[model samples]
Each structure stands twice: as C-alpha cells, then as structure tokens.
Target: MTIRIRTALLGAALAGTAATSAVAEEWRLNNFLPETRPETAQIEQFAEDVNAALADKDFKLTVYSGGSLGLKNTDLLRVLPRGAVEMSLMWSNYLGRDAPALSSVFVQGAISTVDELKAVLPVAQEIYEEEYTDWGVTTVGFVAIPTLSVSVFCRDEPIHTLEDLKGVKLRVWAREQVETFTKLGVAAQIIPQEETYVALKTGVVDCALYPALYASTISLQEVTKYASFLYPMASAPYTLGVATDKWESTDPEIRTAITTAADALWERTNQYDKDAEAEMAAREKLGEMGVTWGEDFPEADRAQFMEAVSETWQMLAEEAGGNAMDYRARVLEALGR
Candidate 1:
C-alpha cells in the first residue's frame, strides 16, 4: 500500500481507540463502613470482580468507603432514586421513611439466626423489589452480615431480665428498636453510630442496644462493663442497590457480570459471619479488657421478651398500614412464627 493509504488506516485505528475510551462506563459504589471492616473489603472485592469481568469492555467501578463521599447511610436510599449516586451498600432498615416494610427484617424477634434470615430473605426481597421499583432503584442482591445479635452493653449494670431494662436510658438506631425498648419501659434515645462510644462513655446513655461486632469495632467494651445477650434484638441486613434506569439501560452482559460478582461476594460475606472468628476474637479481647458477658436470659424472661416484641411487631404493622401488614405477615410465616 502507498504511504497515503497507510496513514489513513492509522488515523482510523486511533479514532476507534478514542471512541472506545470515550464510551467507557464508570460507576461509583458507596459504603458507610470504614475500610478496615470486612464488609467494606467485600465491597471493594466486588468492584474488582466487576472490573475484571468487564476488563475488555472498559467498565470501571470505584468504591468509596467510610462514607468518604459524605453521604450518610440513611441518605443513600433517598439519593439513589434521584441518581445522585450510582450504587450503595445500604442498611435496609434505614429506608423506613420511604419503605417501612423493609424495616420488618430488623424487627425484634422477627428473625433470630442466619438460617432464619436466609429463609425470610426471598420474601423480603420480593417486598423490596416492589418498594424499589416504586422508588426507581434496583436491588442488586441481599447480603447477610454475620448475625450480630443486638445486645445491651451497659457501663455499670448487665441487663439480665425484662426488669433490668425498665427505666434505663438506652441508645438505639432504628425506630423499631426504639419502639421495642420503649414498650419494655426503657427510655430509648435515637443516636447515630458515630456518637455512640462517647455517649456510653460520658453517661449520655446508660446502655446501648447494638451488635456485638460493632461494639468490638468501636471498642465499646472498654467503656461498658457488661454485655447482655438477653435478647437477639435485630440482625444487620446489608443491601446493594443501583439506580433503576441505569440498570435498565446497561448492557445485559455487564449487568450479569456485576450481579454474578455480587452473588459471590454475598456468599463470602455470609461465610465470614458464620465463621465468627473475628467476633470471637473481639469478644476475647473485650474479656481481657474486663468486659463481662451476661448469660442468656432465663426461659421465662425470654418468653416474656418475645411476647412484647411480637406486640411491637403488630403495632408497627398496623402503623405502616397497607402492604406493610401483608409484608409483616409473610416475614412471620417465613420465620415460622
């Protein structure tokens, strides 16, 4: 070929390369947990897996951990529907304002173990699908963080029975938790996670209803003397969601690649929670630091606790109205309650 023909072919090749680069898709995934947490690492791995799956396709995913993007966990669900962010690993219960049914999973006594959660997840996902569809978001998948039982950690007292919790000021996260504690005669204060450690230390709250792993994560063991496993209050169900329109418009193959990666991440994270090595080690460390763990509640007290929780569930369902009552019924059936 002549020099002119060769130059023309080189120009076309460069133009194609630029076009490919220009069409490359970049997605942002936000997580509120610090990078040190296992869940955050799992989110990063998900990004890596998706990028690897689409390596040739020029799709890139960037993960922002520890709320570095400045979006609070509660804000994720609201902003996602508006397309302000591409993706997020959000706490399902935090979406109670928009979708109260989603909070059913976090209801006290609703789900007690990982196996129970797995059983209820399908129905929960169905409920979530309808809710997200209405909100203009799509759920990628449900991830079960290790079944961290929300236990009570007190500075000077251990909550052994229903009587122990009465009249005590306890810090809580969700409205369901607040309602449950309030019915038990406990003064429940809604406090953000970031402020919990100080609240416990400074006597802002006498006790806190939070996960054992999280207590370990924030070093709550140092300030609190006793950890009560009286009630398996709630389990953390982390959800990954994306903008619905973005998902619908994406290439089907890329969506498949991302979803496949998400499924694997879910399994890995679930197994990590099941193994409970980290939680065990954390408890051990807390013990060394003089934190005492309370024995399980006596059978009678346990029964009474569940009865109250059941009542709270009914009240919540009634308050939510409409599909919420149906959703709560489905969750209870799945849990075999």
Candidate 2:
C-alpha cells in the first residue's frame, strides 16, 4: 500500500512538471519579406530582444522569413483572426480586400518628407490600433520601413515623367496606385511581387513602380534597364500582429516584456533619419549592376502627380466607407494640407 501511494504522488508531480515545460514552447512569427532585406534582420533582432527580455519564462519566437510558412500577405486578415498563425508581419496596403477602411488610411507617396511623416504618424497609429482590434487582431509593435524613393523601372524604355508613363504599360501593387495613375492618364495594372519579374520580362508591363530600397530583391536590375525617381514613398509601418486571444492569454509580465522590446524597435526605426542614406546606397548598388539612371521626375510634374493622388485618396476613402473618410480627413488635417 505504501509503495503504491508513493508511485501515485511521483506520477502527479511529473505530470505537473511536463505541463509547466509545455508552457514554454516557441511562438512563430511569419515575415513575408525575403531574408536579404534589412527589415528581416531588424525583425530577427526584435525576436532576440524579446527572448532576452523574457528569459525567465523560457519563451521563444521563431521567425520564418520569405513566407516559408506558405502564407500569403493578402490572407493575413483572414488567417490572423482565426489564430491560424500565432503572429505575422502585416502591411495594411495588402489587406484592403478584407479591411478596406484600414487600407485607405494611408498610401505610399502620400507624404514626402520625414517631417511630414512624423507629423501624421500619430494619427495613423491611432486609427490602425482601433481598426486592428476590431478585426480581431492586435499589434504588439510596428516596424517602419525606411522612406525610400518610389521610382519607375522599365525593361527597355526611359520613363521620366507622367507623359512617359502614359505611353508604357505599367505595373502597380494596389488598387489605389492603379486609380491614382489612371487619374493621371497612365494605364497601370495590378501585379503581385512574386509575379512582377515574369510580367516585366514578357512585355506584360513595360515599367513598374518599385521602391529603390528593395529593387535587387526581385532582381529588377537584371530585368530593367532604365530607372527614374518619382517621389519619396512614405509607407505606413509594418505591423507585428498577434491573434487577439493569443495576446490576451499571455502572462502579463511576458506581455510587458514583448511590448517594451517592441517599443524599443519602433524608436530605433521611426525616430531616425537613415532613410535617405540607405536609399542612396541601395540605388548606387543597383547602378553598379548596370541599371541606367534617368533624371528625377520634374518638380512641376511632381506637383501634378500629388494633386492627382490626392483626388484618388478621396475616392478611396469614399469607396472604403465607414469612417474611412473621417480617417482621411484626420490625416489631411494633421498634414495641415
């Protein structure tokens, strides 16, 4: 009888220890960008910081870069809410189909200068937080992509102005871009990043609007001969979104550690002026690879482009419905435009 009682007590203790060990399992973070990009390293560093911060809990977050998890950026809104993936790096521009209002809050090229971006970011973050909560996910942190110059990369033509764009078939990533270009009398089509190279190679698109920072990621230098700077692209931050339930279930101390580490990342990326320097370096590297650089789009034409894009912004807000126009109004007012 004594031996049996001792065995039962030992089994109970072992089961409790196993349950506690199971609580320290790894969390997965899905990053859509290729490992070559600087942002990927920044994210990996964030994970390391987070792990260090929560060392006592033995928590780990393994980052899967380049979409190795077989998930699409466009599907994050649907998958994230259901906890299909514990966490993901989300871009609002790609989530428009599911969260139109959130998507219309801001667009690339909406703001030109670092001052302008800083002025309007607070408003943007507020709206994003509210909308993401409503969508059944929450942002633990945001990593701002450097404000690189947006440019036209053409396979066989030199495109330097809106007039130049009108004659060539252009590839764009978002509906807002297509509409904005269309409003300026340029014909553009939506093309996914993975498919953009094939599109450019096969005469499907004569030019593509891509940022200077990551042109080499898609081997644009191999396909495009002429590149012309259009405008500084001030994209919204990439969100580190976790399922709402998952976040809520996390221990409060661990949550604090995660957020504290994330806040550090935001400060490092958002409050700095590394964008122009980084963009210049990337462009020089692209030039070294034989991409012919064209003159920057003229200032007179840039004004016209901004005007057309402003109108498109209004149209996008109206189409998105439900406080989207309100959000746009808030952003415009913040920009003091």
Candidate 3:
C-alpha cells in the first residue's frame, strides 16, 4: 500500500486514544528510521540513560525502531497530539503537510555551512517548540543530525552542474527540494529513501539527490556509478517529543530524568567538528565500496542553486500561511542573511 493510505488507516484505528497504558510509565518511543541506522542506536542509548536516571521509579522507555509500531512518520503530527503514541522522534520536513510552519522553520539547503546551522538552531528550536506545543506535543530535546555532504548520484553520466541536471529526472526528499530543483528547470520528484535505489537502477529516475554520509545505508553505491558533491546538507535536528498530556501527568522526578537524558543526547551529537569527521569517513567508505566520485560542483552553480532554494523557502512559508513567513524571517535574522 501507498504510505498515505497506510498512514490514514493506521491513524484512524488509533485516533483519539492513548496507546500507552496508564497503569505504569512505560513509554513507547517510535522511530521511523531503520534499526541499522546510527540514530536508532543513539535513541536506544538515550532510553537507557533515562531509565537509569529513573531507576527507583516505575518508568521505562521502550524504543520501537523501523516503524515497528505500525506508525508512519507522516502520521506523527496527527497521532502525537491525540496521545495515540506517547513519544516519537519527529523530523519536521516529513511533517510539512500537517505542520507547514514547523517545516518552514528550516530547510536543508537553506543553510550550507555548519556554522550557519549552529547560528540558526536556537531560533529554529524556539519556533519548533511553539508549533509542537500548539499541536499538543511537548519538546523534550533535539538530536543533531550530522551535517552531511549532499551529492548527485547518477547511473550512467555525471551531473555536477545545472545544465547537466536539466533533463535528468532527479529524486528528492522534500517538497522544498522539488520546488527548488524545478525552479532550476530540473524535473525533481519526492521518492522515499527505501525506493530511491530501485528508482535509479530501474530507470525510474536518472539521478538522486542524497547525502553522501548515508548513501551506503541503502546501498546506493551499487546502483549509481557516479557521484558529485552538491552541498553540505544541514537539516533540522530530530525532535524528541512526548505527548504533552503524558508529560504533564508524569511524576516530577521522571520528567526530570527524561529531560536530562534528552539534553545529554543533544550535547553528544551537536559537535560540528565531529559531524565533518564522520561525513569524511562515510565518504571514504563509499569510495572503498567501488563508487567513483566526480569533481566538486562549480562555485557559480552552487551559488545559483542556493539562490533558487532560498526563493523556495519563501514560497513554502507563504503557502504554509499563518506566521510561517514570520518564522522564516526570524530564521534569516538569526543567520544574518
């Protein structure tokens, strides 16, 4: 079944209900990423830390990875508010349709450098907290995603410039990416990460825009022969959110434990230098796997791409309506753009 159909059915079945039992504080943390991913490992550690902190209490945090809870990432905004799930690691880009303002707070290509990302995060988090609270979810803390290098992974030919991308069917992740690439006269579509490898191998798409740090996770190196540097994708952090009602009703000590654990997770992952080092390591691993790397995209073309993506940010904010533009302005102000 399509993700939308599956999400709708699952949402309906669990709507207006608390999925977690009230007898104990055993919370289910839903992670949409695969169990093999490092983020899942970090989340698992966070749960362990929280449990340790609350050792004397009857509180436990169980992490369900790889969508094992039968919950879709896109359905999180709807289900989280109703307490259908007690906790989730939510990425705002996946939630654009339901929480446009939240998505508009930051876009991957909007900030190119790690310093820019660091400068803009506080403002972004403020906006995220506001939006999540309005949606009935309490933000505990955020886990910083590594600032990975984005690349154009193509099958037969290299794509390093705007001209080369014009006729190529490119796979992107978010609507903002689709709009930006489309503005640059490229045909870009949103394909899920799981399907991207097959899309390139079977000629469903000519190329894909993905992070070099994560290409090996889905074995993109096997399908795409040529890869070229695009930009450093500094995406917004993953939010560790709990159903607000559940949070409020919990014991004060347990709440403190959860908060402490979440804060430590954020600190552990927020190192800019570590992010760069990891990306470099991942890129090297991709090369050892028999993938051929192309030349860096030209500075002129990078500038043009960023300009187009900036326009897309504004378009998304206006489309989202209701304080989205204001949020964007605040983000820009933080970046001094």
Candidate 4:
C-alpha cells in the first residue's frame, strides 16, 4: 500500500477515536427537588436531546434528586461556580450570595402572569446579572418552568384589597416580596418552602404566599379556607448554568454541539411549561374546586384590586437598589411601561 493511503487511514482512525472520547464524557446533573417535579422531567428531556447530538456519544447523565447532592436553594451560586455541583435548574429566589441585588426583582404585586414576566425579566436580569464567567460557569439564559399563579393563603380571610392585607403575617421569600407586603402592613415571615406550609397551618404564619402549584403539591388549600383570586407574585424564573471549568476542559466541538442542542431543546422546553400550565387551569375549570381566582370576583372588587397593584413600582424600584429613578426612566425608554 502507498504511504499516502496508509497515512490517510491512520489519520481517519485517530479522528474517529477522538470523537468517540468526546462523546464518552458523561454529564451528571443535580436537583434539590424530587424527580417528580416538572423541572427535573424537562431537564431529563434536555439531556436526551444533548445525547442525541453527540458524535460518538456514550452520554450517561443521571439526575440525583431531593438534595442528595447536598446543595440547596441557598448554596447554588457557590456550589455551581466551584464545581461542587455540575448543573442546576433552580430559580433566583434561592440565591443571595453573589447578587443580593437579584433579591429585588421579585417585588410582589408588580408583575403577575407569564407575559408580564417575559417583558419584565430582560430588565431584571440586567439589574443583578450573575457573574458566571468569573466563576468558570457558562450561563444558559433563563428557563421558564411551568408553575402556577401566586395565591396568598391566610388563616382568617384572603386579602381582597390593600386595606385587607393589614395586620396579617405573610410568608415572603424574596426581599422585594417582604418590602411590598410590609409596606401594606402585613408582617413578613421570611422562610423557605419546606417550613412555609406548617407555618400557615399552625398559625405561626398568618398567611403563606406561593404559586397555585403549591396549593395541590402541599395541600395549602385544605387548611386555609379562603383562596384569593389574588395572584400577586411573578412566576419563579430559573437559570440554566453550567460549570465553566468543566466546560473549558471539555472539547470545543462537544460544547458547540451541547449548546446548539440546548438552544433547540429550549424552544420546545419553554412551550411545554406554558402549555402544561394551561392544562392545569383547564382541570381546575372543569371541576369547581372551592378556590377562586381574583379575576372572577365582582367588578367592584376588580377595580379595588387594580388600584392595589398600582402602588408597587415606585417602592419596588427603590428596594431594587436605588430609588431606581434612573432605572424607571430607562425601563420607560426600553419598554414604554
């Protein structure tokens, strides 16, 4: 055989072996919640799509759930950057480390519903941007996971108006939430998810603020007789970030392939979340589950509710960092809001 032909065959074999090695790298994912949650399920699908795109993929990605990896909502910023954990699909509410400023993005009663959220996030992400690059992490833009409307579960009665919220103790997770509720005279009980339900039931908390998904998941509706049609909080927005150190060590082609695959998958992933929420609403509509959405209440009450939400922005901008007078101007320029 000619030397040229022999060299060509050898080069081809080596190229094939390198591709095989790249595909063989397994991705290990970590989750603080149970595998049953929709976020985990959708991530599982993302992994599948990523695997399909690998050239020589031996992709083995196993998800460890329920905080088995020892990371919680609070530890994500440190854990993810240090490579103590690989990837996380958790929300901004859990973070307080690198960006305490991010805490203000969820100012209660300002933005509600997904469309409002989508419009608001571009501004919010800019306020307290995660410094992933410094920590050797590659940030995948925000992911919208399917969750439901925020409802306040109170011991006595659901808050129907700004005046109604007075003298109530409400569980608020974000700094903005605390400020918003406190300004309205509700005592802010700053606590995590696991403790919130018990607080509401035992009277430790006069009220608990959470998504409608929590209503079914934790049975908040059963203990609290009144369900407010008041969905005051924004849907929790989670980021998709990867370990930069690991990513840099990984082959360029693999990174390209994975990112490309993820972008493609996200198109569907977002739609899936929004779609699932619709189904949840449909199920609720089909059955009269004693609960009422504030939108369904009397027209007079609706006018009152609209008036209550109007007071949110000024204070929300103040708590965000500054009076955010400058920001308010910028946002008005950007969104004309």
lDDT of each: 0.78, 0.88, 0.87, 0.60
Q: On a 0 to 1 TM-score scale, where does candidate 1 land against the true structure?
A: 0.85
Q: Best candidate, lDDT-wise?
A: 2
Which of the two, 1 or 3, has more lDDT?
Answer: 3
RMSD, each candidate, Å?
4.8, 3.5, 9.7, 8.0
Cα RMSD for candidate 3? Answer: 9.7
How well is each residue in 1-337 modelled by candidate 1, as lDDT tens digits?
9999999999999999999878867888888877777777778888999999998886788998877888876776678878877888877677778777666545756666677877877777787777777778888976666766557788988876767778578888888777876777878988877788899989999998776766766778777999877655335467789999989998998999889999998788765354457557766777888889887667787777677777887887888786778888888788887
N/CA/C clash count, model 1: 0
In candidate 3, residue 306 scores what lDDT?
A: 91
TM-score of 3: 0.89
Deviation in Å, model 3, residue 184 alpha carbon = 0.7
Model 3: per-residue Cα lDDT at residue 79: 94
- Rank candidates by lDDT, best first: 2, 3, 1, 4
Pairwise TM-score winner, candidates 2 and 4? 2
| Model 2 lDDT per residue over 187-244, tens place | 9999988788999999999999999889999899989999999887787888999999
Q: After superposition, how far is residue 202 of candidate 3 from its true place, in Å?
A: 2.7
lDDT of 2 at 90: 92
lDDT by residue (1-337, candidate 3, tens digit) is: 9999999988976763544433456799998877878888889999999998877776788999878898878889899878878899999999988888876788868887888998998988888899989988999989888888899999898888889999799999998999998889999999988788889999999999988878888899899888999877788999989888888998889888889999999988887787778877877898898778889899998989999988999889999899899999999999997
Instruction: For candidate 4, write residues 83-181 as lDDT tens digits.
Output: 776676656666645545444455455555567666665665554343445445676545565535555666676565645666676787766566556
Task: Give all TM-scores, in the order shown.
Answer: 0.85, 0.91, 0.89, 0.72
| Deviation of model 1 at 202, angstroms | 2.8
